[model samples]
Target: MKNYSILSVTCLIFASLLLVLGCKDDTSGQQNAAGQQLAMSLPVVEIPTKTLTAYVTYPASIEGVVNSEVRAKVAGYITDVLVDEGQKVNRGETLFKLETQSLNQDAAAAAANVNAAEVEVEKLKPLVDKNIISEVQLETAKAQLQQAKSSYNSIVANIDYANIKSPVDGYVGDVRLRKGTLVSPTNQTPLTMVSDISQVYAYFSMNEKDYLNFIQNAEGATISQKIEKMPKVNLLLPNDSLFEEQGTIETINSQVDPNTGSISFRAKFDNPSRLLTNGNSGKIQVPKTFEDAVVVPKESTFERQGTTYVYKLDRENMATAASIVITQEIDNLYVVASGLKKGDRIVAKGVSQLRGATEIQPQEIPFDSIAQPIQKVFR
Candidate 1:
């Protein structure tokens, strides 16, 4: 009986040990499976070589081809605003009318003086002819009549100046002086402005270095020839939309601005629709072409300490962060200058979630699917 009890206790102890070991083995297997599933599945693509055109943008200001300020010829209170803002007017059309009541009164008084002088000269003419008065007296009356006529003409001219007229055929700008506002030629502010919008000018600037590069790269010996050879440029509107009409490089300032250390350039665009007006602001985009350039999607790039990097993949699908130097950025692509080559495999997305030497299951994708469509690229 004692041997049977000891054998049963030994069997129970051995069974308990086996159960604990089995549970530990199962837990270990589950941990290993979970770690295997943690490796992320990311998309990748091979770099491409293509001819791409990039744009270098600079701030631009829009103005009408002809901008003329409308000023009052004589000082007077404004009585009539003949034109409204943005109203189209022809040359010599009335723009504003100043109060002319005082001028009219002066004109009437001068006319009466002329009539009196003429009557006195006529009365003296007969007396001089009859020898009733000396010839000197008649000559004196004639001189007074001439002076009165001159004064009358002067007053009449002033009354005509009270009606201000448009100097050019254009659309009117802001009316600075309203009804009852006094204005004159010497006043700093103009009554209004008129601009011809049949065509427009887009003025932009380039630094000294860029100017030098542009002239040297152009295919011409003279500045005028270079401008003719330059490609047509595009304007980006204030809302970030591209202007429908393209512009040509019309003029390059002969001298650089001493204060800004930059040179100004003027581009002209046909404004048949009158969409552009004076004081409008936009950006000028100059196209630059790169032949057989190695390009990458900007999405795959990451910056670290001022250095740009990309996750380049090897045959084993292991990603290594490699530094790259970018030459230019076009829309959604980067033109690489160095540190990367054509046909190199790179991670397409999720670069921030990756680390160096990380192994990934690379799902190959088309470059176009990863990169945004380029805008206004020629070829």
Candidate 2:
């Protein structure tokens, strides 16, 4: 029995030592994990207060100040084409000459009738003065002469109409007629088009909702007053290049097109280089400037269930999920409307790898380093 008790005691002592060793191993493992959790490496940015401009781009149709379709007034075969496409022309410049041979023949016959009527009037005048014939006969001869003169004038006008002239000082558009092609006022196609592009007009449409908002935001007591106070706009050419010259909003349609549910707007842009041509399509960028707005990088924000959030680093370098109300989105940046202010630091990148309340190792970067240049944003 004593041997049995001694063996039992030895077994208890061995089990106790094993339990102590297991506890020490678990404590050491926890300590090692805590020590390894150094601050997470994250690029951060301080919220900045600056003037930010937000723009919305819409497709626009370019047109010259004047787009005149030069059509033939008199029907005849095109005998000569005087101008080429893209040629700069002035008002009254002849663009095409039509064959007036038939017109000339008609004019010649009308002239013969005019001459015969003149001779008849002269022959009757002397007799009427001498009382050799009734006064009614001389009056009838005079009326015949008047009718002949009218016929001659009509034929002359038609002959003059054979010369097609440009109605404006502008560049020539597509020339649809060549020599031997017949054109006239009733023809469905025009001989060519003249576009006065010295100042070009860009036509764009704004939906009713946007139009109302735009006018409301503009500073003025009336619609016209608001339009006058609106800022200038920029154009994005078809090649994705920006136009050097800026444009101003000139006019808006009086009523919205019921079928389209949008109002048309015309913006005038000076085209000294003649780069903007008729029928050229591009985009118009209208910028709305926000002064002293709190801005943040859009990459730092994440959307959850339609709400946008970001990891904002506090004084202790701990990340807190902040829900920000954005007033506008400008390229890769956001203008914060609320929930954040200037001087608040945010994780510029790597926000997806962070969890709330976790500490961060901040790598601060300049605001411009993360966002586009201010001039580019507006330009």
Q: Estimate each model's TM-score.
A: 0.75, 0.85
Candidate 1 clash total? 0
Alpha carbon lDDT of each predicted model:
0.93, 0.90
Off by more than 4 A, model 1: 1-13, 23-44, 109-150, 300-305, 309-323, 343-365, 374-379
Model 1, residue pairs in steric clash? none
Give one clash count per candidate, in the order shown: 0, 0
Give stretches of model 2 more than 4 Å off: 1-44, 313-317, 360-369, 372-379
Please report how far candidate 1 places residue 140 from its true position, in Å: 8.8
Q: How do the residues 130-184 of candidate 2 rate in per-residue lDDT, one tens digit apiece?
A: 9999999989988999999999999999888899899999999998779998777
Reference-based TM-score, model 1: 0.75
Q: Which ten residues in a row have the lowest lDDT in candidate 2?
A: 370-379
| Least accurate 10 contiguous residues by lDDT in model 1 | 370-379
